[model samples]
Target: MAQSQPAQKYGPDLSVKLICPECQIPNPNVVEEFSSGDLVCGDCGLVLGDKVVDTRSEWRTFANDEGDDPSRVGAASNPLLDGVDEFETMISSRDGNSGISKELQRAAAKSSHGRSERSLMNAFRDISSMADQISLPRSIADIAKQLYKRVDEERLLRGKSTDAIIAACIFIACRQAGVPRTFKEVWGLTRVPKKVIGQCFKVLERAFGSNSPSMTPGVDTPTLNNVQSGPEDLMARYCNHLSLPVWLQSGAVDVAIAAREHGVLAGRSPITVAATCIYFSSALFGYPKSASEIGNIAGVGDSTIKSAYKILFNEKQPVLASIHDKRANVRNLPDP
Candidate 1:
């Protein structure tokens, strides 16, 4: 194919389609030679035009007939998966296609997403979806993916409760990211039994050493921290959910932290301690949060909240004394 040379004159888009210039022929049979950017006289063999733009695409691809892709490429590979190079085969969708073709389609679809990749994809999606449902941050989703990837790489808990493991991954992601959620809250979101989730958590804890780095070396995924978040950590979220006033929210957090420091609610779940602090804070500030309300949000019973508050009541001076804000009048705090 010869390239078109720079012609002195460029013809208008074959205006001579109506008639021939030199031959005086009407409605000339002109042919477009797109390869060399020329239009020639189909009958008289004249160079009717040169330097004509081809107007055809110059790029092509070997990729599956995906729309608008001019280069040989496929979807971006996930770094989280161990396998990449997964192959695919296209099967005709037209009716009367042989059963062999359908079989080939199924095989290709399965191979295109390798078993490990498929599992990781599903787990990642579940983690993200669960996080969104619980109103957790995007960072939690990313971290959870990383943690799950590590677990997969190590082959931890082979053939075990994968859902519980995934739920535990999310549970750990929340605590490790510092915006912790209680196990009950995680249970509420995942519906995984708390005992099963806890068992899976232990497996993950050993897999990714709680006080140190993960099992694999040179991996960028950080080691898991203390999985159990403190009572004070729960107060901020619980207070916000209760819609307590700003002063009362702060006062509640202060009381919770003080309770933890003073061992006021020892052997109690962080959720219970947090609910107690909220109920106590409301009472002190005259904002009155019934045990039922706090219990419902905190995933504890009213009796549990009242019981914990009863214990927390005995240490009112130590807890309220920790409040630097003078607005929380100790004189107004009721004795339980």
Candidate 2:
């Protein structure tokens, strides 16, 4: 039997000739070879490849070169370009889908119009940066986005200023986040007037309430708690004289008494006013806080929060002792 011969290799159909830089001899099919960069002549081993070519169109591959290593000549020049072709293909396949096509077209148009796209992208980045800087929760950030959308819609639909609308959105977001930020917070965020915030608050409240009627306001979801007023405002309003310490003590006692009194007035059995008094006084003082910290617990700001320290601790001592003993079921009540 005769020995089998090796399979013959064929050249490209539209091969071009290239002059070797080394040998000055003509080298053909430089554009057809899958290899790129400097190429050597098959005969004299001289560099002959055309470095400048329309890479996307005039490229080829050898049998040995086909593998997952995209580094192969003409496979993709750079790692960055490796997945780009596939991505473009995927995008093209989805192009006929109305929504996807519209979005892609919009993005393409945006890219084509460089200035507006860059500016718009920068604005989005700024919004994201602002959200991160403030350390807003996802719920709060979503609320902010909703606020922005609402403001934009309101401006277009009802003819409001952009500033007013943005302020309204931020105000609504803070409130929804239970941040207790005031009109001042809105003013600080948007540089709008307090009255502007107030006006927008009314409008936004009506809009939100109309859209979601189930969201009625209550103590737990108090409108004040949503606003962000700084501690300075409440601190400025502090009139109680027994220092911060005595005031907190008196406040706690007074809050307890007030709750019990209110329960009595309502003809209910007087129970522990631990949460209620702290909550109520927290609001009145504008220091608005959670239930567990101020009332049941003892601290400086806690005491005078309920009333002026003098009234609860000095004048009405006996009444408090009685209530205290009753609360703990003590056999003997002590002096206040």
Candidate 3:
């Protein structure tokens, strides 16, 4: 009776050359013969090796298999944590008999390492809360967290209030994301004064040097003035707050865009321009919101809105004429 050949194992894709001993071929094709568990010479079918092991991954799928397989073990680890991705310590609630001792817990709390860890945790928690309060997106929150981490790593938090540093980081993140939040708004939300936040922001920007994530490569750090909102950007938002009609809302946008196009908006605060646009558009459309009403919604004085409105109206006649023509055309359209 013929002896049974051992089953073969398949190896991964690899390019290798080996001489066949039996065939005496200089470089015989030595493919893994998986069915017989041997590495054999293709020319003579001579088994040169046996009992090979297949080291490929066991998880396999076919063309007809559903892609939503639930076999995944867990989420991928975050690289920021430096390989220690899980919590190493846990607090025990029970303090007597079967529980951890109070003295040990107290000692752990008093340690310098524990104090630093607690400070870091508290700062991050405050960042999350502030981000949520301001309705910031998750990407901005992540940027804030990254900035805070860098501050902590650089020991820049030594003499500064943690709250101030966190607020400053969030402010920078808001600017970087072009979210249009002002320092005044951040101060109102965080209760950290503007001066302290400003100082912290400057210190962080200095410490970050060329490595600052907020600064684009080859672009200088933007001044506070550069990041402020433009008139057109703020028009719709202020209009919405006042609950104006669609025509007035759209007219406000057109006024803002025209002012920008004609350079009438140069060196003007966007809030002021947006306020003026609202007041002007309301009057032009015959709904006529008061300067005081528009100013109150925009957080500017009525006098400022009035002054900006006159300048915009006088300097942008061509734009105003075009808008007037468009409105006349709309009114003349036959009702369906």
Candidate 4:
């Protein structure tokens, strides 16, 4: 007679029983161990089964009050991937017995939609690379990306170069963020022609003009007056760049402000005005700087600085007189 195997313990509270056929007794004392993969009888010392399979939940939960929590199954999605959140299913080339044939995969690769998607992906990748090269913040990069998407949606890139448009978008984003980057800096980083970037910038400005509040969030929209930097805006920076004394810097700022109020800055670039202010203040304080030095610091030329200086000195005599009086008063005061 054959012996029957004892049932295994599937769980803490669940088990199975087998009758011992060799002993012809329904034995309740049965031990099923996994070390030798056998089922044996405890009372008769008989081996009833071998190579038995254990069936139970592999997930174990410690602490009777807690429930089982499984891990997430897939990778997280990215917004930069457009609308496609998951990888495209492709036919495996290594599996010869697979049901998906090679012809279908080849056809999918040659589709027009795939080509366009690839072009857009390449453009966005370039934008991100350019942004990082220029050390732009993540928020500005995201804004630039959104601007590029809008330009594409409007079909404005049909005749324009992609690199130029992306450069212009980054430039505008920097301006809106008040990052103080210049067109020359942007051009140097992107290697795009300055004229092309300017044209693209004009197009973007027209597209997101006063009516649209989309591009200039957290900042005032660009306007005719606010678009250009003022002489006062460039004064301190130019002074710092030249390493001038604090008194000279304050005097230069005063001269620039006076020039602005007297219409000396009308129809003139702020850089030239700032250079001229620094030059005039330097002369009055007996610590004069050359026009070339001032021009270099203020990003203008010597001739431009000379012309601005002539205009301010020839037209604004009272303002210079007031600055001279202030200097005299400071000189007359006793040392602290």
Candidate 3 residue runs with Cα over 4 Å from true position = 1-113, 156-158, 205-211, 214-228, 245-250, 322-336
How far in Å is the alpha carbon of 86 misplaced in model 1?
A: 10
Per-prediction TM-score to the true structure, in the order listed: 0.67, 0.35, 0.58, 0.55
Error of 4 at 109 (Å): 11
In order, candidate lDDTs are 0.75, 0.44, 0.71, 0.69
Better structure of 1 and 3 per TM-score: 1
Ranking by lDDT: 1, 3, 4, 2
The 10-residue segment of model 3 with minimum total lDDT is: 327-336
lDDT of 3 by residue, 1-336 (tens): 999999998987687557897787776788796666788888888888999786656564334356644333344543433342333355676766754666667776766545556666667668888888867887777777778878888788678888889988888877666676656657766766789888998887666544556434465544443564666666766777888876777877887777777888578777787788778777777676788888777788988877777777677576676677556522221111
TM-score attained by model 4: 0.55
Model 4 per-residue lDDT at 178: 56
**In model 4, what lDDT does residue 5 have?**
97
Lowest lDDT sum, 10 consecutive residues, model 4, at 327-336
Angstrom error of the Cα, residue 255, model 1: value is: 1.2
Q: Model 3: clashing residue pairs?
A: 7-36, 7-37, 8-36, 8-37
Instruction: Tell me the lDDT of model 2 at 97.
Output: 55
lDDT of 1 by residue, 1-336 (tens): 999999698667855344557676776788889878888888878887788887766455655556634463655555565546433334676647557777766776667566777677778878888899889988777777888888888887776666787888888877766787877777777656788888888988876664433323575444565455877788778878888877777777788777878878889877787788889889887789788999888889999888777888877777777774655364476766
Best-matching candidate per lDDT: 1
Q: Using TM-score, rank the candidates from best to worst.
A: 1, 3, 4, 2
Per residue, candidate 4 scores C-alpha lDDT tens digits across 1-336 of 999999976656445457776676754566887767888987787898899776645554344455634333445544655654344465667657664567767776676546656666667777888888867777777767777877887887578888899888887776665555557657877666788899998888777655333444576545322455556666767777788888788888887777776777567766667778888777766567788888776667899878777777676566755566656622221111
